[model samples]
Target: MARLTAREALSYGMFGNAAMLQNALDGKANISLASRSLPEITRQLRDAIAKRTVSAEGYPEKVGQPAISTELLPWALFEEFESLAVDHTGETVFLPPGAPQNIPRWKNVTFDAKEILELWPIANQQIDAWMNADFANNPLKKRKDRISDCTRAIPCTFATATAAFNRSPSKKRSRGQRATNRP
Candidate 1:
């Protein structure tokens, strides 16, 4: 977003491209380019940059190369920025008045019941292959085993199937973890 805006701003004779890139690196120019609520995150980033603790001073102004790199930001500072970015998801939080409410966001879509039933064997085959190939090395084996169990226990409630498919069954009892829909 900042790069596009910086290019546009450069086209309008606002500032030099190198200076714009530097400002973006410093987190000073991109504040307004981001959502209103995210300005605080940008501000915090700028504060960190100004402290010289997360400096990217030697970056060159190459045309195809990126000016601002997150690699320069330390893990601690990155975590701090991430914590401040908790409120990152809101459809209309930063939009101006009269702006469109829905701008087409990505969502986790689930397969329909028919699709799930049809794909069960393929999924089970993949799981079996994984289990045979690198079962001991992969930490996902436990969850995959649960999914294998869930695949056999078809004609079950979507919630129960999903719970079994997604999670490794715990030794301790939990209310929602019970396979009430199991035949």
Candidate 2:
């Protein structure tokens, strides 16, 4: 996923309309929140527009288990569908399946997955530089690094611990007993 610039975020919040910013400042519109990724921003925008909130259901047995269940109002159902569509496609931009055929077209819209991936390294470098600059400018927010040392280690972690049980002594004795009992 692509990380949106602050300028892009401001523009998106206004949607090319100066009145939107004015409304937001005047408390007539909801304030937009900054997020680490575009998808997070989009979700926040959608939630703000719908006046909705999301809560985690519960943790599952495995590490990557998909926690299900969401509560959405009738009018906010479209946002739920959009979330499901994106999750299914594994893409940031997607049109929900079974969209109406007569839906209005969007102009000058292009889908370029490759372009997003190419900018990742540059984006990471820029973000790292910005973080370092911020830290230098503000000592109060300075963070510390922690290190830990392991004192003990176990041997033969992969090798089986018990092999005697697997050696079938009864099977070996069975062959010798059969030869002696043969008529």
| Ten contiguous residues with the weakest lDDT in model 1 | 84-93
- Model 2 lowest lDDT segment of ten: 146-155
lDDT per residue (tens digit) for residues 53-84 in model 2: 32111112224554343222232443545542
- Model 1: number of backbone collisions: 0
Q: What residue pairs clash in candidate 1, if any at all?
A: none
Candidate 2 lDDT at 24 equals: 55
Model 1 residue runs over 4 Å out of place are 1-36, 62-172, 175-178, 181-183
Listed in order, each prediction's TM-score against the native is 0.20, 0.21
| C-alpha RMSD for every candidate | 20.6, 25.5
Q: Whole-model lDDT, candidate 1?
A: 0.32
Per-residue alpha-carbon lDDT of candidate 1 for residues 1-183, written as tens digits (9 for 90 to 100): 112221222211222122333455567776343222334433343344345433321222345666453223233433333232111121112222233333222111111223223222223333333333432344343544544554443234445545544443233234456533322
Q: Choose the strongest candidate by lDDT.
A: 1
